[model samples]
Target: MSRFSFNQITAKLWDLPDLVAGCVEAGVGQVALWREPVTEYGLERSAALVRDAGLSVTTLCRSGFFQAPDWFDDNRRAIDEAAALDTKVLVLVSGGLPAGSKDLAGARQHVADAIAELVPHAAAAGVTLAIEPLHPMYAADRCVISTWDQAMAIAEQHPVGQVGVTVDTYHLWWDDTVLDRIARAGERIAIYQLADWVTPLPQGVLTGRGLPGDGCIDMAAFHAAVEKAGYTGPIEVEVMNAELWERPGREILDATLTSYRKVV
Candidate 1:
């Protein structure tokens, strides 16, 4: 329970202030925030609110879409935002191949190069760039970095704290060799996220994640690997189910805590 940090997306409709108060009430001391909601709430204001509440921000949602024309500026802004929130890790989602482009290899390489270029800025801000490998189902449309190996390869190119990989149970559960690889990752492992993998994924494969233990993933194996890697960071529950969002936020948080207790 001490390691648990409730990711805000687990209750997407929950207001920022309400979420902070809810976390304090629930005894959740850490959080993972998204960009849009934080932006809407105002950057410094959100930071001050969380700071005043004594909440530790584990990481920001994401900021890497290498194909975008303004990717550099956008990522720099994200770095600044993460700094403002007093969070050390800024999640990076390497976007899909450019429109109508069949060059998967090219797109991935571009992501690595883009991260390399952004390293100085991230380092200057004292933020670690945590590359997230979305599930392979999203490789064609959402993310090109779709495996632990891919994320690690890019991360290993930079200094440890300046760049690292995200360990999300929903994405890595299907890979048989991932456990061993993750155990060997050591400091290259950044934040660890939890979202059970459900079958018959919804369209676009974005919002159908199950809470921990709701789906068929062997979550215990993941925990063992992360522990073996010597990672003591926040364990964020980041499910994105539409049905869950329809429920009350407090109910959702309680359910998430229950699910987390069962898995951990």
Candidate 2:
């Protein structure tokens, strides 16, 4: 059976305790947390609460942002936090293209460099860094790693068993070679995320995602690919639409679980 988790991104806060409580109440057993909340709660405290509540943390939300001046420092801190939480994966969102720098290739290189620099720290902490490929639309501001193939190439540059990639359906659904790359990733498949995409609107990326069955993507195919790759991690629901965020938490959680079982 496929287990489920919630990405703190869907909750929009850095409070791991609150998010953990919500997940426990919903009968979810795992979570992927963002850095800010963990920083606030202290990694040890966050880990304690999750374990106390009988929940396992799936992965740390992210550790890379190469465009930032403090790239090296950022990742080091992320490794420390992941280790403290006893999390097995540290998801990295490779930085976006810097302003006036249309050089996508160069931005990707920066990501490689950062990962190379941080590998030792990650290994020492016993944490695996998982690269996350955002959709091409966020190519300019969010992440340069935009495809499974690209992420796999980056993973190859790292030492075996130290780095991997996170496959989020909301970002990979449009890719023609998603399955091919997921299979190639094999054990490098560290985190598998599930969310939906709706029609775009004026506000931003938030408007584009819907609940699982509400969208048109072939979720079963996507899940099959990950399973074929031997990925047995929690299926994380990471919806962040304004509508869902605004509704009562229980309603959103109920709808999410229903969609997960029925559509995912």
Candidate 3:
């Protein structure tokens, strides 16, 4: 990892301007921003904010909730937003099954088809639709793309520059075979995110992630595999703990840097 990026969700409560200043003070030259806050801060201004701070926007948080009715237009706009932010990678979290829908296979197929449709737009916008395989527990609601093979299957239909997979430790650590495949993924690996898996997950399973090295994942092994893939890109530390979010932004950045150094 050349630069450590502090993901916005890791400090969700932090204001965007304050986050930028804190990152600069912490010597973090990179960040992964979410769409909502970026939009709230105004797209052009958000881009200017990070640029003025001498920070790089690693990857836009997400776009692909294919099950949504307006996914087509929404994703295109998201692609444009990523371009506006000067980030090439736009992470896609393929939405899970539709409400009360039991056709899991159909839902998965829709995700593939939706991604295929978005490829040209993403390519035109100089963006890569990075498929993020959420953990299996999110299969029913958050994401249907829950494994490396599943994500790659859809991504392989397009060029690696336009479509690729996000290698996130919190989501992939349970899979023993993922590291080897990641080693061979080459250019298909678009972005890498870090978050440790801690036990006794909270309700909704969203804000329970631990910082790197604070849980069971062998982050060194992951780092080795990512390097083996010839990936020397920005590595984002994206922990979403409610407790961590409650702390002051500067304190969180300090702790995040400490955790990152321990694992890196």
Ranking by lDDT: 1, 3, 2
| Candidate 3 colliding pairs | none
Candidate 3, residues 178-206, lDDT tens digits: the string is 99999999999999899999887777468
Model 1 global lDDT (CA atoms, 0 to 1): 0.94
lDDT of 2 by residue, 70-115 (tens): 8888789888888887788998999798878999988998888888
Best candidate, lDDT-wise? 1
CA deviation > 4 Å runs, candidate 3: none
Give the poorly placed runs of model 2, Cα more than 4 Å off: 13-15, 200-202
**At residue 37, what lDDT does model 3 achieve?**
97
- lDDT per model, in order? 0.94, 0.81, 0.93
lDDT string for model 1 (1-264, tens) is: 888999999999999999999999999999999999999999999999999999999999889988889999999999999999999999999988898899999999999999999999999999999999988988987799999999998999999999999999998898999999999999998899999988887774578999999899999999999999999989999999998999999999999999999999
C-alpha TM-score for every candidate:
0.98, 0.93, 0.98
lDDT of residue 172 for candidate 1: 89
